[model samples]
Target chain A: MTTANAIRLRYALRRERFSLDVEAEIPDRGVTAVFGASGAGKTSLLRCIAGLERAEDAYLELDGTRLDDSASGLRLPAHRRAVAFVFQEPRLFNHLSVEANIRYGRQRRSDRSPAATFDELVEILGIEALLTRAPSGLSGGEAQRVAIARALMSAPRLVLMDEPLSALDAARRQEVLPFLERLHARLPVPLVYVSHQQDEVLRLADTLIALDSGRVFASGPLEALLARADVPGLSGAAAAAVLHGVAGSMDDEFGMTPVESRAGQLWVAGRHPNGTTLRLLVPARDVSVSLAPLSASSIQNSLAADIADVLPCSDDSAVLLKLDASGVVLFAHVTRRAVAQLDLRPGQTVFANVKSAAVRPVFAESPPGPA
Target chain B: MTDLGPLLLSLRLAATTMLILLVIATPLAWWLAETRSRLKPAVQAIVALPIVLPPTVLGFYFLVFLNPNAFAGRLWFEATGSTLTFSFAGLVVASLFYSLPFAVQPLQSAFETIGRKEYEAARTLGASPLDAFMSVVAPLCRHGFLGAAVLSFAHTLGEFGVVLMVGGNIPGETRTVSIAIYDHVESLDYAAAHQLSAILLVAAFAILLGVFALNRRRAAAAS
Candidate 1:
């Protein structure tokens, strides 16, 4: 499969004390999650792209269109630019009713694009009953749904979500994230999701741009960048990678998506798009090793990979193995118990059995690694 | 027997004065609440001046200014063929000046108390400044406007020195409720004074009750 058009943003933007220094490129076709700590300037970088904040020496081009280039002093105003931003707080207009607030951004779009129907959005967000209520009356989840609906209505070329779920509690976040997944899979516009949570980015993003102290720490395919043991906070135990696959056949009776990946046939239980790519993450600790592929197992996925490295840390209790499949590096933490049982050794061909449900997509990079 | 002439004249003067003040104060208070002009503090202090000055001081200035011999008085006399003092119009002017601050400060403070972040939210969403002011600021400042109106009306109803100096208590031409009560008291007709005092007390209480009742309605609506 070919990669879609993307944005290339390079240059430095400095202010008196806090400066946003960056060099990065994100695909124009899918979600590019900016993951960082609270003060790592993730939101500032988004704001610069959205034209909400001006930055000197900031060069940003989206799919070949020059949106901001400060070397020659070129920039677009927030409203004039093709980006719509959803702040951490819902920020719905209090004087307006829910319906009116959703329509506020809809009225601002000058170009004709495929807009999410008002009814569709309200239905998807489950906010049909809240149309006439004032913003003051909405609960946090409901208000965020309205915010998301409002932002989507603008038909932006690139939508910026600045910690949209950060203000929500866990249960509420769980409720909204699935809707976000479905929305991203459905919408045509690219998204730049900014978050501090690695789980969220792992579950949602196609491209991950990890920032540290206002600099790009790593930028690439979410799974590939994250799978490497060298990724700051993601090393050893926390290392995880996103995997993309297509639904091969329906097993509705068993409730599984038969995914066709280079890792071999993997079956994950969910309602997945038939042929389109679905992203899922496989954490480092979740995989188990066996010299021979077990056919009688209950686990769904058994992938064939070559052992890339075997780092034997102090404890014979466990070992870190880097398995390479083409250009992808997947990590597995085998306990000393399993290593001895299977007689696992370096350069040995092995079958790594990972539960289909245990796999999830790379959504966000680990927080601004090491401050 | 009740004197219908003075009561009717007083009611009419009070009604017109309050109405004009409401219209004038609404916009002035709105501006005072939002604008950060260099002149705002001075304007606020001046609006509040009427509350502290003796009514006679305020009235005497108006009285002199509106005298036919004075420049303003001569202009009105030549232009409208009306002398300034001892007229219903002159009492209206005096009452308005006296109650101006009562109508402004509460509203200004109310407007100021509303957070600026709310307005900024609307602006980034593509609302013009005027639209944000009308849609965001005005609705939030509703309570202050009501308070100012109630206070100004009640304060104007109790005016004495300004009306006495500028209105001259002409029975049907310039007299007000306060002036009528004063007239009865001065005449030493204890019975009449008591009757007028009872009526004024009831009126003030009723007016305050209505303000409070309306405030409750506004609160419910806001919620």
Candidate 2:
């Protein structure tokens, strides 16, 4: 009830070109991603919160402790603040070997004890083999992994990552994402990740703070905020709603994995062991709605749902129908003509039509939720 | 025979000048690289003055500035009881000024190469400002330090006009290898002049070669 460990930041920075002024509160557990396009002040916000950039009218508090408050003239220097940053570039000390880079923070940490043990961090990040190697020899993925481990070894209360995966190519990104998910599951410290990638947000973020031109566009639980239709230009044309589900069954013959959620069982083209928690992103444009189920349709997924709400699309030429499937929320983008034909209203039962191919598997965690 | 006095004096002066400049230029170059102050350009221009100013002009100003009657000269006289011109201490002051850009330019460029990201990364990892510089900035800029030290030492070794004006070609007191070579040449002692000049030439070439080799290795490793 006390909102202990919650992070609150309000800052205003004025410069010649871009000025960032934003206020946001994030839960101090799980990964809260600051999602935005480039030049959205994502990195600037992280720098300000880390105390690297001083801002006018700045107020930053973690839980109840004031880390920075311009009104009170209390500003904790970056070194004194228990925040670790994983930069976009690995930024490893080229002079130091991997083992030394990871230990650099630990050696200088104000608290002698670390929140995560060194062995555990190395094992989780899969960096044990790279321990003695110098940073110059590391591939992009390997260097980023070491950078993450190094940040964790410091035992910070918070970790701010500025597009840690942005610099890597696709294959390298795939290589590092699982380790990130593992870190997310294992570490209790809150992580604030700044990224322009939607897939990364859908996969990793528990809370999403969407930014637009240095201001908070919207901030809330990833599921609820991303589903809202009025947030124009959010994630571009591929914008979709995210749903959490548990893997129910896998059929080898069909090469499909059945994911059961409050919205009902949906088949996706993937294979995961039963009981693994999965995150699915169903694009709104991919979904179709009808008053009754299509019996002879090639489209695979059809679920009975009640109309939750109606909101205009960004251009107002269409309407986004919010569907409440059991307790889960799904969005369907339909033409005004379709809505007129269906006469969809709140409390009305309708079939939400979805193609199994459209149900993309975003991410999977072995043991879900913060540990 | 080596006649090792002028040679030793030259080595000692170069070594001492390099050491003092390292101490003085590290912070100044770091500040120049990192500060966003309005006066940054003005400060940078002043630091770069010696590179463009003719050695004779700098030497003339230094001669007047270090005269026992002037402010700095009077202070030096009071502190060390010796006139600034034609003394070993005066030679040191002149060398420091002459070789300053050599010491600072490489360091400033190196600090610039390291950039603010690493420093910020270090700070987030709970390193104080000084701690970050010592641990993160210093090691990362080792190449810069190498370049600066080698260049400063070589530049001091080859110095002629500034040392001549300030040190007054005094043997065993203020005379460096360059001055000694010049004295030998003026007196038509071609053997002595060639001996000292050869040493300077070989030493400068070897130092430069070492620097270039190290830089190439670094570049290759980076690639």
Candidate 3:
């Protein structure tokens, strides 16, 4: 992307034990997930972008606006940056009611664009009933939703979320993830989401920036990066391919749904309405390779594929194989002994069996309507 | 019958001292709570000196510093044709010093308890530093402000040595309740002393009761 349509960041911070040095240009659209382990400078990077933590040698430009230039001694304060942040905790003002907390930023916003109306955000976050309640009375999920609404109401040019769902329990995370997905699809302002949870990234992010030891190990489109078997954390045990497809029809007798994608047709164990777009997450471990098509197998989904590349896993017992299934990429984890026995190589034809039960449908596109 | 002038003068002095201390202690307490500077301990020590140092010592310093010939006293004398020593204004100044810790300690602790996370959150939400403090910090710490005001007022009302050294015994201008009780006792009038003393004791108890009740309510709400 051109400089006018991207966020360029160059920061170098040195502390007693840990140091951060990163330089990247991220597209100013869609959800860009900053994925890394704990203490990988994820929160530090977000803080620097929000102007909360000033790096001595830093230059940050968002959509061509010079937010910070250490060389010229120009730095905008956090309030003036028009960059809103949602912390892991709700951090709502205890003195104000939920409605007041959400309106606090909207009233003080310097940009009077009226991008998202108060009623619309309240409805979108499902916080209309919580407007009059105090933040202290809300549950973890409810408070977080209010916090998200507060950030959006600020009319920020960019929004930064630092593990917005990390503090919650599993059920609360599930409760808030749908609202986040809705925001991902509907928000005009780009989001830089910091998370170590792979499932959240796979569900919400369009682009991914993986950080290792405070440096950018890889940065690209999410599909392309996750498809690479060579990247350490992106592959191996957490390896999964997110396939975009449209729902074809539901088999009422078998209780399954057929999804059509560029790769091929795959039957998932669910019922989805026809014509709705869906993303299916197929884990590599659930896929097994056979030399020829299995005539009488329990696995319902099978596709003919050419072996693209075989990569060694961290543990030597198994190997991760990259498969190109008609222009769509998929991964399969097969044992080293099986690879040796079958003598699998690139350019060889194989039938990949996928367990329909293991295929999870995530982030379905809502039917077009008032929302 | 005991004269009521000293009691009224004491109330006026305490009210004036509480108001002025709140204005002066707020920013100082906020700085003390938020700053990581090396000078923080030193500033805190100076603010707390009144609680540890004898009131006579502070009064002696005030007397020496605010006499007619001294710099501050000369400026006051030139401007208002009166010295800062042995006046109602002098008593007010002495009471402020006597009650400085009462005003600052509660406020500083309150600010520390609220922490910087909420303040930073407000800033990112497009509030300036001052705006964040007023909208977020002040309202959250309203009880702390009230506690400070009450403590300062009570502490100033009971002050004896500082007023005796700096303000002397000017009945309506500077003689407070404490001095009036002392005067009554020194003149062998036990009845007058007992009446004023009982009034001060009940007033102090009521003010403290109000503060403790407020604190209990806050704690209950928090829990």
Candidate 4:
């Protein structure tokens, strides 16, 4: 497989208590985060994609090459499929030294483009001191780092990580997460990171597949998917909004990047120069609506947007507003009193006044062009 | 009182049994643990039958039926020797049947506990069946191999009834430590019997205790 626009999976598997029925296409691009709760069949879905489980009529294709297709009875064994998997646990062989495990994957490659250089990955994951130790001797985080390096060393077409960080404590997670981010940003292989944590999802994923009870509840670009508050990990007030805009200018006085959107100019605190596409998260609760545009306010910019739709909230009159600002869904959860006071109605134009402090700026650019 | 021939024979038999069993039991146990094939339980039961069966009954079947004028029996005699009835070879055969469970059970449980996830991980990493087994399964379950080895060695060292039935009481050929102790007691040599029995007990205890200590060490490390 030549690696761009890879995996396609459409399959059904019946278990005792649940049936895994998911249809997904993993872009042969950057990280695709599979977000779900514990026991939501996240691991099983990764397993199926990696060719660990056999399902009937399982039509799976990677870069136009059929891995499994019952139409012609073609099933490529996992070893032949060129998919690297990082399991929840490190699963490192106790007998092999750390270098050996890393070399294990490198040795499996038939054609090597750029091997995840031992020194580079060891430095990247900070596993240099662990080279001589066996897996049984390494700490959990250390073992997992070695595991990731090993998977990368193979130079496989796609890498699948099944909750690779859930076992770590918060501090260890923080330590490893940046290395993981670096790995994805640098690696040539497409990565499929399976995680339930929203922070991990937002920090890493370019595309998202939110799994709920053995089904793909939602799957799309991370910006669009994270905008849906009803998506499990993207819930309540915290994980509601993803805003992508192009940098227009840097305002030294206000310390903000003048980001341009279809909604209008947004004053966001970002370090990028003019004309860099960026993605940032704005939680819905952070966004409050003002009927009239305010000039003498601490809030940065007021953009015009039409209310797209509304859904009932806890109270009878209170509702969740889906605002369309240049095709981006910005959720605003306001009480019924405010809704009536603002004279909010679907298809009615209103000023969306948001604060510069409200937007949590993230360094994001478009998918790297195919090399 | 302490002629070391029987002790040497016991060590030889135990070591040989473990070596042979490791080759046979590993794949058998791995398959038993991994496959959902039908007749699995039935096959496992058959392998485990010698553990539960009366030693005399098992010895009776092996001694009489195994050496019949039948085609298999003639072939066995011709390949090895006509004197298969009372030899160290015969004792080794008897010990293998008697000690099968001690080796197979630990290895089977160990292989079972390694779980499908490790194999799945290895498979996705481009390791084939043989590669996964050597690199992943075998190393990950090292304690099981140790337990199986120690159990098989000690079990073979303690073989008495099956050896007596299948391997006649020949001093150098068939007489293991347990058999030698039995001979001393039967001859009214109480002091010699006690000495030989004490040595055997100490050696067996040391082996078993070492295994349990390793098991505890593994458990402690895990916790």
Cα lDDT tens digits for candidate 2, A1-371 = 12666789899987777888788888888899898778766777788888988787799888688999999899999988888899999999888899999998998884657878889999999989999998989999999999999998997888899999999999999999988987777787889999888778877888888887778889888887876755535532445778778887799888889999888988888787898888888888888998889899987889898898877766467877788889788888888888888788878999999988888776565464442
Mark the regions of model 4 whose C-alpha exceeds 4 Å error after superposition.
A1-4, A35-40, A94-99, A126-143, A168-177, A196-199, A210-218, A223-239, A246-277, A311-317, A364-367, B1-4, B35-41, B78-84, B189-195, B212-223
Scoring only the second chain, what is candidate 4's TM-score?
0.94
When 2 and 4 are scored with TM-score, the better candidate is: 2
For every model in order, what is the number of clashing pairs? 13, 0, 0, 0
C-alpha RMSD of each candidate structure in angstroms? 6.5, 2.8, 2.5, 3.8
DockQ, all models? 0.25, 0.85, 0.90, 0.67
DockQ of 2: 0.85
Which one wins by lDDT: 1 or 3? 3
- The list of candidate 3 runs beyond 4 A from truth reads A252-255, A365-371
Backbone clash total for model 2 is 0
lDDT of candidate model 4 versus the reference: 0.79
Clashing pairs in 3: none
**C-alpha lDDT of all candidate models, in order:** 0.75, 0.86, 0.89, 0.79
How well does candidate 3 score on lDDT at residue A228? Answer: 75
Report the candidate with higher lDDT, 1 versus 2: 2
Model 2 alpha-carbon miss at residue B190, Å: 2.1
Q: Model 4 Cα displacement at A135 (Å)? A: 4.7
Q: Write the per-residue lDDT of candidate 4 for residues A1-371, one digit (tens) a residue.
A: 22456678787787676777888887887889988888767777777778887765488887788888867888788888888999888988666788998888777775765446778888878888999987888878888999998888777888899989988999889878878877766666778999988888887888898888888899987877766657875764444667767887797776778887766777887566878776666666667777778888888878777788766655465577778877777877677788887778899777777777777655545556663
